[model samples]
Structures are given as structure tokens and as C-alpha cells.
Target: MSADQSVAIVDDDDFFRKALERVFHSAGFRTESFAAAEAFLASYIPKDEACIILDLRMPRLGGLELLDRLKERGIDVPVIIYTGNADVPVTVQAMQAGAYAVVEKPLSSELLITRVRAAITDARARRTRRNQSASARAKLKLLTEREIEVARHLTEGLSSPEMADLLGISPRTVDAHRANLLRKLEIRSIAALARLFVLTELGDS
Candidate 1:
């Protein structure tokens, strides 16, 4: 996690919320507490290196509802749902809705801190990957029409001569385009260029 990474604790229970805050603070981690999910949403603070410890049974905006809203808003912040009662269906739904983990109430302070640190670390990695994909997409936009055409063919495992034949261009011209593509994309191999396409496409999540 980065130096400024934090943990957000959203729960209606004053006792539990303060306990978590103390545990995190004692561990030298930054934290922000919210009385309810709605308050957290209303604040609308986005953190690249933070995760949420969300209570599952809050009134009005419950954990599941908040999870769905986060999904709708394209928020991929890792969430660990905390619930006092262990409901099988709700736990399954939370996981399916993309919760990082679910912990039943009466959680051990040590275990909770462990999970929070792991979630924050995972969130940081995801943010880094997203930034890299965005950078790759921006760089890809610099390519000319012909260069993009060459890039697609390169990803399809086409040799210079094969691509030239398909486009009705000379093999030497295709090779020149390939060279330009490698330099423009700052990639060394055909495989690496193809990998970028895969990474950037999945970044929509």
C-alpha cells in the first residue's frame, strides 16, 4: 500500500466502528469512519489505495445495496462485508457482487487488520494496473490508421509477408509499418503488443 492508503469503516454500531478505528490506528494505518452507507456515498471520496469495511445490516442503504451501487458506479474498491448474523445466501450474494471477503461479527482485531491490509494492498495493485492500461490506451491512440491496421495484424500472429499479402502491400512496406509500430508502442516483441490488447480490454471492469 502507498503511504496515503487508508481504510474506510462503514457501520452503524458506534462500539464496533470505534474498535476498528482504534485497531487500524494502532497498526499505523490511516482510516475514515462512516455511521452509515449513505453517509459514505454522500461524501463520494474516491481513493485509489483504499478498501472499505462495510457492515451488512445497516438500515436503508445496507451492504448489499451499497455493493450494487458501487458496481453500478464502476467502483472496484475491495470490500470486506461484516455481519453479525451469518446468513448463507447473503454471504454468497456479497461474494458474487464482488466483495473481497466476508467476516462474521465478533471479528478478532488481529484478523480484521490482516484482511484490511490485504485488501488495501490488492486495491493498490489494481489501481496500478488500471493506470498502466489507461496509459497504454492513450499511447495506442497516437497510431495512424495504417499503423493501427498493422498492429491488429501483428496481434493476429501474421508475418510481414502474410500481412502484406492480405493488405495488397509490398512485404518491405509491411516490415516498415511493423518497425514503426514497435517503436511507437515502445514494445519489443509481437507477443508483448498482443498482451497489451488483452490487458487493456479487461480493464473495463
Candidate 2:
């Protein structure tokens, strides 16, 4: 995760919120607390890079409702539910609703920190994968039919001379196509391009 990653905590209890905020701050996370789920939802953007620490029960727009809204919107921020309510059905529901973890309250500082870090890490990984997919799609959009063919060959470790021979073009033309490929793909080197190609292939699959 980047230094700017945020963790939003939504708990109605004032003292607990402050304590958790302090703990998260001490653990080197940029933390924000909201007394209500509605306040947090209204104030915060649904950024995939951020993680949410939500109280399972709240006044209006409870954590479960908030999670439902997030899912409906296709927002994939990781959620860690923390609540004193340890009912089996509630825990099972939270997990089924796609919460990263459901933590029981009277929260252990060490355990909370560890879970938050892991959730943030998971969120960051998901965000990175989504961004890569978007980038690959953008690059694919920029490609002409010929360029797509060239890119496929490039991923196969074909040299410009070899590509030129295969495509019945001059080596200079192949070099030009390769340069265009790099710019269109927004990648610097063959390795990066190859990685993009792999991602594209995986996305297709």
C-alpha cells in the first residue's frame, strides 16, 4: 500500500472510535472515524485503495446496509467488520456479504492492526489489478489490427527483423511499429510490454 492509503472507521461509540483512531494513527495509518455509517458513506469516496473498519450495528444505514450499497455500486474497498455482537448468523452474513474479516469487539490492538494492514494490502492488490486491466484495455483500444498482430509477435520474443520477415515488411517498418506499440501501450521496455500482454491474455481468458 502507498503512504496515502486511508482507513475509515465507522463506530457510533465515541470513546472507542477515538481509541481506535489513535491506535491506527500510532500504527502509521492515515485514519478517519465517523460516528455513524451515513456520515462515513456521505463523506468518503468509494476508493478501492482504501479499507473500511465498520461497526456491525449502527443507527441509520448500518454496516450491513453500507456493504450492500458498496456491492451494488461495484465498489470493491475491503471491509473489516468489528462489533461486540458475535451472533453466528451475523458473522456468517458479514462473511457472505464479502467482508474481508469480521472482528469481535473489545478489540485487541495488535490483532486489529494486523487485520487492518492485511485488508489494506488486499485492497491495494485489487486496485492494482483493476488499474492494470483498465490500462491493458486502453492499449488494446489504441491498437490497429496490424499493431495487435505485431504485439502478439513481440510478446513471443520476436525481434524486429524477425517480425518484419514474418509480416513481409521492412525491418525499419517493423521498428516503427514497435516504437508505436511502446507509446500506445504506455510501457517503456519489452518486459513491461510482455507483462501487459500477459494481463490482456488473462483478462480474455
Candidate 3:
């Protein structure tokens, strides 16, 4: 993620929230503070570019509940849970709910920073993969029905002659379709095309 990426800190305690904001700000991260989950959800856009620092306890909807809401909406931002209790069950539950980290309250600046950095890195990787998948889907949309058939065979590592034989088309036509698929996908080689196919499959699944 970029240095401009922000972190949202949601904690009911004013002192802790302000302290966390200061720490994040000093580390070159833009920070926002919300006293409750509802305020944060109402105010923030669910961008995959940002990370969320969530307090496990709050007045209205708790951190776990907020996490569920985000997941249901397919918002893939990274979340780190902060809590004073530090019980084993709570920690396990947070991790199971896809929290990047569960940190105890009276937080360490160093550990918190490290976890935030890791979460941002993970978020960026996921965003990149999603973008690549979108590109692949767009490329696939350019294919004609016959070209798509040829492309699928090519993605399965079939040679031009093999695809021609299987589809009962001329070798020259199969080769033409292969070249068109490459150009449409903006890929230089068959290996890159195959990778795009795999990525598209994974994205759909």
C-alpha cells in the first residue's frame, strides 16, 4: 500500500484512541478515530487500500460483529483487533474471523506498528491479485465463441495442431485463434496466458 493509506481506529475510550492515533501518525500513517463501530462504518469507505484497528469491545456493534459485516459485503480490508481482556477464546475467535492480528490493550508501539505494516502488505497483495483477475476477465470477454474454445484448449497446454484436431479446425485457424487470444489478453507468451487462465479460475472459485 501507499504511504498515504489510512488506518481507522475504533475504540470507545478517548484516551486509548487518541494515543493510537498519535502512534500511527508518527509512523507516517493517516489515522481516523471512531468511538463506536456504527460511526466508523457510517463514515468510512470500505476500501481494500486501508487497514482497520478495531477494539473488541464497544457500545453498539462490537469489533467481531463489524468484521462480519465487512466480510458479508466482500470488503477485503485488513483488520487488527485490540482488546484488554486477552482471553484465549477471544484471541482464537478474532484470528478465525480473519483478523490480521489480535493485540492486547496498553499496546506496544513497536509491535502494533509491525502488525499494521504486515496487514498493509497483505492487503496490497490481495488487491493486486484481484486487479489481475479483473484484467484477465476483461480479456476473456473479447474472445468469440470459437476463439474462447481455442483459448481454453491453449490454456490447458494443447499445441495448435492438437487443438485443431480436437476442434476439427485447420491448424492455421487454431494458430490464428491462439495469436488473437494472446493479443486480446495482452500477454506475450503462452505461459502468461496459462497463468491468466489459472488466475481467472481461482477468482471465480
User: Candidate 1, overall lDDT?
Assistant: 0.86
Error of 2 at 128 (Å): 1.8
lDDT values for all models: 0.86, 0.82, 0.85
Q: Candidate 3 lDDT, tens digit per residue, 42-84?
A: 8878655578999999887999999998888777889999999
Per-candidate TM vs. native? 0.84, 0.68, 0.84
Clashing pairs in 2: none
- Residue pairs with clashing backbones, model 3: none
Candidate 2 local distance difference test against the native: 0.82
Arrange candidates, best lDDT first: 1, 3, 2
For residue 118, model 3's alpha carbon misses the true position, in angstroms, by: 1.2
lDDT of 2 by residue, 1-205 (tens): 4356778989999999999888888877788899997787678777655788999888878889989988887777889999898689999999999999998988789988888778878667666676777777777779888888888898899988999999999989888888897887777887887787666654322
The worst-scoring run of ten residues by lDDT in candidate 2 lies at 196-205
True-structure lDDT of candidate 3: 0.85
Query: Model 1, poorest ten-residue lDDT window?
Result: 196-205
lDDT of 2 at 5: 70
